[model samples]
Target: MKILHLETSSRNCSVSISEGKTLLSTCEEISESLNQSEKLHRFVEWALEGASLTLRDLDVISLGKGPGSYTGLRIGASAAKGFCFGLELPLVASESIATLAHPFLGKEYDVVIPLIDARRMEVYTAAYDGATGKVLEPTTNKILSENTFEKYQGKKILFVGDGAKKAQELLVQQDSTFLSEVYPSSRYLVDPAVERITLQQFEDVAYFEPFYLKDFHGVKKTK
Candidate 1:
């Protein structure tokens, strides 16, 4: 199956082209000020060209549905939905946090956690079984505290994602480990998206929305 994956859940924006389990091409950029609507399509074209393919060649369009930036998630969802709608293609949605932690799948660990900054010491996170990528602890918004993750203290837990640094500081004095380099990428969506495709788990393109764990509150201006 030929798949095109899009990830714009955070400052790191990325896209990937994959055929079954093999990644054909991937591109990413980390820029806080980027206009996602403009750059996302550009990266999409770049990935397709690099893979020697075109939009019509894609079988499925996958997206990193987020608990990250509000604007980023909207941009990604809009683009993916547009493509699916326009091309009459199926759309698959993968959890943004799961995509961030997916690289650690099958690793030697009791659990894996992916964190996304929720601002002001809070984060959107979930725990997954490292070997099978099963959800060990369901998704939730957690407020950082010194005693966090106490339930998994005796087990080896690998923490990852853009929000891992903030979460790590709170768990550092405990038996937790952190992976600083991990960030959400479209390439990580290939396996899960493919699995969904095999199961015929396509989303309703018109009604799908990014998993925004919390309502977005715009900053107030004070002059």
Candidate 2:
């Protein structure tokens, strides 16, 4: 199952070449800003070149479908669909929060919550069972409050991703652990994407769109 995964849902713009769960190569850049339209193709080419493969050799094109940046998600979706259309390959789409949680699938924590910073106080999040990676709670946008996630108070809840930083003040008082360093990346897209590919759960390249949970709002330029 040779796959090319694109992740542009966050500041970390990444591309990964993988064969099933084994990652062959990855090209990533983490900065304060991301311009996927400008860098996506180059990163993909770099990853493919390093792996000594081309788009034609891939069995599927995977995309990190998101509840992250609107522009970033659009860019990634366009590229994924284009590659699938051109190469006549399948498309496997995985959520950004799920990809963020993939690396913690078998950890000791009872519950794992992956969050992507949406703005000042809100985050896009979903809860998953740590051992099995099963969704205990589906993804949604949440605004932090003092009692947020209090229902799981005594249990070991692991909070991860870029959004965790902003919620730290409140969550720190609860029975929660924070992993502020975890960010979205194509490398983490391998496991879930492989499962989708094996199940033949391919997306319609012609009509597929990323999960942009909210409407995009562009800032009005002021002089």
Candidate 3:
């Protein structure tokens, strides 16, 4: 099946075109500012053109439902639903956090954690089985401390995502590795997405919403 994937869970705005397990085209840009409202559609067109296809050619519209930026998640979800509506295709959602762990699935680690910065020292995160990609610790928000994640200490662990650096600073561990600059992208959003499609797990486009782990709190005015 032909699929189009959209992921804008962080500063990175990404789009990809895939067909049954193979990635055909992917485009992404990580800007200091959140500009998904400006880049998403353009990247979608670019991806479709690069893949030599069109919106009507797509069978499913997949999105990395986020626990990241509120605005970014809104942009991505609106665009995904728009495409599904315009093309009359099925929509499926994948966890944006999982996209962060995809690259390290078969690496030298016993567990993989994807972290998204939340309020202050808190983060939205979960642990995935490093080898099988299974959800080990379910997603939730955690306030970072030196004793954080002590349960998974004996195993070699990889802490990756935009918030990994924070964990590295406090959650001290002997065998943990941190990669803080990493962000979710559509390039790695296709596999689990396709698996969802294969299982016929289409979302209710009318009511689907991005998983915002915490409520949005605007910044205070400096005056």
Candidate 4:
């Protein structure tokens, strides 16, 4: 089974192709000059061309449906939906938080917290149990403060995401292990896609949407 994965939930934009369990190709660009809307197609084309395949050869298209940048998520979702519709392939929606936390899967952490910056002091956060791959808490909008996650003091917590750097500064408690360096990517999007494909779990492309934890607050035009 050939799968195409797209991740644009953060500042970095990545595209990857996988054939069954093997990763065929990956292209990543981290630049403010190129937005996902403009860069995604080019990256996908490059991956397909490099792999000596075409969009028609893909069996599934997986996307990192996000809690990160609203515009980025929309661009990714739109592209995924378009490809699914055009190629008549199944659409797989992988959670952005889950994708970021995918690296810690099967580990022995009591809790895994994946955060995405939501601007200001707010973030899109979720808690997962690494041992069981169970989400202890569903994704939600949270504001960082000194008292955040204070109740889980004794438990072993591993924190990761683009927002981890800021979260680390506020989470001064001695109990938590802050992984401020981990960032989301297409590499993390593959395993979840494989799992979903094996389970025959597919999304309805027509009605599918990105998971933006908060309402988008972009600049309004004054006409």
Model 2, span 1-223: residue lDDT tens: 7899999999989999998899999999987767778899999999999999987899889999998999899899988988888899889899888888888879888889898999889999999998888888899999988777877777788899988888787663556788877889999899889888889898988889899987888899999
lDDT of 4 by residue, 62-134 (tens): 9999878888898999999899988889988888888778788678777888988887888889988878879
Candidate maximizing lDDT: 3
| lDDT rank order | 3, 2, 1, 4
What is candidate 3's lDDT per residue for 1-223, written digit by digit as tens? 8999999989999999999889999989999899999999999999999999988899999999988999999999999999888889899998898889989998889999899888589999999999888899888999999888898978999999888887888887889899999999998889888889889999999999999987888879996
lDDT of each: 0.88, 0.88, 0.91, 0.85
The digit string of per-residue lDDT tens for model 1 on 73-154 reads 9999999999999999999999888887777889798789888888889988999988888898878899989777787878
What TM-score goes with each of the models? Answer: 0.93, 0.94, 0.96, 0.90
**Model 4 residue pairs with clashes:** none
Worst window of 10 by summed lDDT in candidate 3? 165-174
Better of 1 and 2 by lDDT: 2
Model 1's TM-score against the true structure:
0.93
- The worst-scoring run of ten residues by lDDT in candidate 2 lies at 167-176
For model 1, the stretches where C-alpha displacement exceeds 4 angstroms are none
Off by over 4 Å in 4: 32-34, 221-223
